[model samples]
Target: MHTRNVVSGVLLGIGVATFVDETVFHQLLHWHHFYDRSTTAMGLVSDGILHAASMVATVAALFLYADLRRRRAFAPRLWWGGLLAGAGGFQLYDGTVQHKVFRLHQIRYDVHLAPYDWAWNVVAVLLLAAGIVLLVRGRR
Candidate 1:
């Protein structure tokens, strides 16, 4: 039960952090998105992005895994897996269609880093798969 609180807090925290970093810092500080790519600090921004994502993943991964352990709750599933999965879904969608087909920079948190895009999609898929596994196990 205690683990549940900690886990939920973590998931929520990750969502908040994502909102902050993507919406606030990247947008305001480095001018990653709103401004032109040439104007943005492409190299520093991309490297920093990967670093932050790794950190978030490291902590959020545990929270999500723990949520899956618990039988049922919005906190466990929604905040934990659903949020991460949703974020991942975005990556997968962005990578598959947005990057190639649309050529949209809807959310230009990173520079034109294909490696970052690839990694994001891969991790996003893993998060969704892990969430499904947890959901399946919880049903048993």
Candidate 2:
């Protein structure tokens, strides 16, 4: 149960999730931006900022992971659990706080949002649940 390993994994997970959101939804699909209440240029800037932050998190996580590995203190199960939890937590926050509360952005526009919202939150819950299970099991 190395705390550093879990922290590293969590950071990596957040980075991966943000990367996917930025690349797939924001770029490939032309979906909403991080801040939609602005012009296209502003949106692009916001996306760039998000991308940079995610990259920083990823690099930091990798460094931590490498250190854990070098010390032979890597806890695979705990790390994986943290990874899933972090990903799910981020998605859940985005889906709820960002999408609904702050109105930062929606999953998609000009569509029935109910289904997408439900699916997004549901998946987040599942991921979080699985992570919790793994973490509990790993403790034994």
Write out the backbone clash pairs for model 2: none
- TM-score for candidate 1, residues paired by index: 0.44
lDDT score for residue 63 of model 1: 61
lDDT of each: 0.52, 0.89
- The positional error of residue 130 in candidate 2, measured at the CA in angstroms, is 1.2
Against the true structure, what is each candidate's TM-score?
Answer: 0.44, 0.97
Compared with the true structure, what per-residue lDDT tens digits does model 1 show for residues 1-140? 43443345445445544555455645466434422334346645653664477467646755655665665544444344444454555456545675556654433454766676667568768866765555444444
Clashes of each: 0, 0
Give the CA lDDT, 0 to 100, for residue 110 in model 2. 99
Model 2, 1-140: lDDT tens digits are 37897788789989988999999999999988998999989999999999999999899999999998899989888889888888888889999999999998999999999999999999988887887787787777
The total of clashing pairs for model 1 equals 0
Error of 2 at 52 (Å): 0.6
